[model samples]
Target: MFNPKLHAWLERYFYQPGYFEIVISTLLLPFSLIYYCLVWVKFKLAKPVKFSIPIISVGNLILGGSGKTPLTKAIFNEFSNKYKIFIILRGYKRESKGMQIVALNGVIKCDVATSGDEAMEYAISLKNANVIVSNDRKIAIDKAISLGANLVILDDGFGKADIYKLNILLHPAKEPRLNFTIPSGVYRYPKSFYNLADITLKSSDIIKENSIIKPTDKMVLVSGIANPSRLSFIYDRCVGYEHFGDHHKFSKFECESILKKYNADSLLVTQKDYVKIKDFGLKLSILELKTTILPNLIDKIDMFIKSYQISDRIYSNSQKGDLC
Candidate 1:
């Protein structure tokens, strides 16, 4: 179902559009308008269900590569000591279906195939929190509550208008030249939707530190993530680069072949990609990128949690009185 060429074309069309891309985008304007209307209706008709537990949603307006996972990890690290935290996601490209518990109370319960790359990354990286992947977010939240989670962090949850929570929207360092939706461009939601978020953060708001251990002077960069161009910071140092579709499962043979093709001593990859191939017994150098939330953002999150704990009105789908 994943076409690498199509993916690459869309990326260029969305972010670095020239005259041809602009004309194509213009032709797709009607579809974008229709998509916008449908989303607007969905939000208007949404009856978001809220629970007694505090929920923090980190999401973005763009389609992908907005640093939601990193931000979620940062938030988990900040609050995991205080509350029984649960991180929930849709498990974008997992092989399994239904609600899957990737990790529970610091113990990993599933493998990469079952948990997907991002969820598995969370399970392996954050030990104190639970990680769950499910298409039905309401069911996932209920499961987390039953498992004694006092706080929940939803990854890429902005579109779930049916869930009432403190919304934090992330913006990429550089937005697309054309802000069209879906086929026309990469924006999942209109830029105006940013105003609805409880806190909207730019890429500059967070600090990133990149480090590589056992580094090679020139290595081949092999990555499977959205917006690979964002790695421009490390481009000058790499001898070669090979990009795959976001969350593409890499095989031992493929990795070895890539290394040979570039004639490089090692393959450089992101942390998210590392979890999948760690057991492959291949030569790898990880591009360890750590993200930290600013103090002001942390203070805002604390305030939201405090206010949520004391609030009496529980958001619900029904017009009846609030539950609990």
Candidate 2:
């Protein structure tokens, strides 16, 4: 299949949805329906395995850019002091991964290639929580429990049925209220599964307000993420942009070309994109947009922890301090 061209079509189809998408997505709707049905049956046939510790999942039905990563950090921030926590991700598009450890107590060991961009971002972002990369989440979670994690959080794990967890689906503010299944649209799960979410959250709830937003005379928005538009705020002053496929590994030549193509004096990227290329040693000035997981959601999560008896140890008075 023509993957790149299809991806471009999808971007327009999902975000703009004019006559082009109306016709294209309609023709592709049957395929999306079949895929969704197959997935639904797969989940139904699989048995959910419960870990010795609680596994909380932060995910979304939409394809990407729903703020699941920041929300995961938010949950991590809430319980890191009290629980032995670890994050499990599929290490999407990573070179090496069969249950690799990325971080321990906030210290990262592996390069971004061993751990995908999102996992590496978590490793760099969280100073205390451990991050693990594996396509088979069961192996990762089992490893986490063995490594003394009382809680294992799965990132982008909405489709994994092997382990049951607290399902938190994030809805981005900019995302349309309703969405369709993939191929035709960005929704991976049918909208009917909306009721499956234990709690539905708005991405705006976690988006940091004072996000880095200094405008420049000439800026090139550089990113390789599922939903690059989430960083649209950076475009307010952007002269041009270059978006590689999600989790794309950047080469020195590519970075240099992006600079030349846009004739950009400075380069701007999201934290997720920054981790992948921070070591590329590019010459241009790079600015990163930071995301903060607000504190309001913590109250609801804390209550769930207590209700389910997940843990009693919250941050002590001395530890009770800041929000990320």
Question: Across residues 46-146, which tens digit of lDDT does each residue of candidate 2 receive?
Answer: 78876557778888887766777777886787788888899999988889947899998888888888888889988987878599999899988888888
Q: For candidate 1, lDDT tens digit of each residue in 158-234?
A: 99999999999998878888877876888889888999899999978999888985678768898999878778788
Best by lDDT: 1
Error of 1 at 267 (Å): 1.6
For model 2, the superposed segments whose C-alpha errors exceed 4 Å read 1-8, 176-178, 213-218, 283-296, 310-324
Alpha-carbon TM-score of each model against the true structure: 0.93, 0.84
| Candidate 2 lDDT score relative to the true structure | 0.76
Angstrom error at residue 258, model 1:
1.4
Off by over 4 Å in 1: 1-8, 312-324
Reference-based lDDT, each prediction: 0.88, 0.76
**Range of the 10 consecutive residues with the lowest summed lDDT in candidate 2:** 310-319
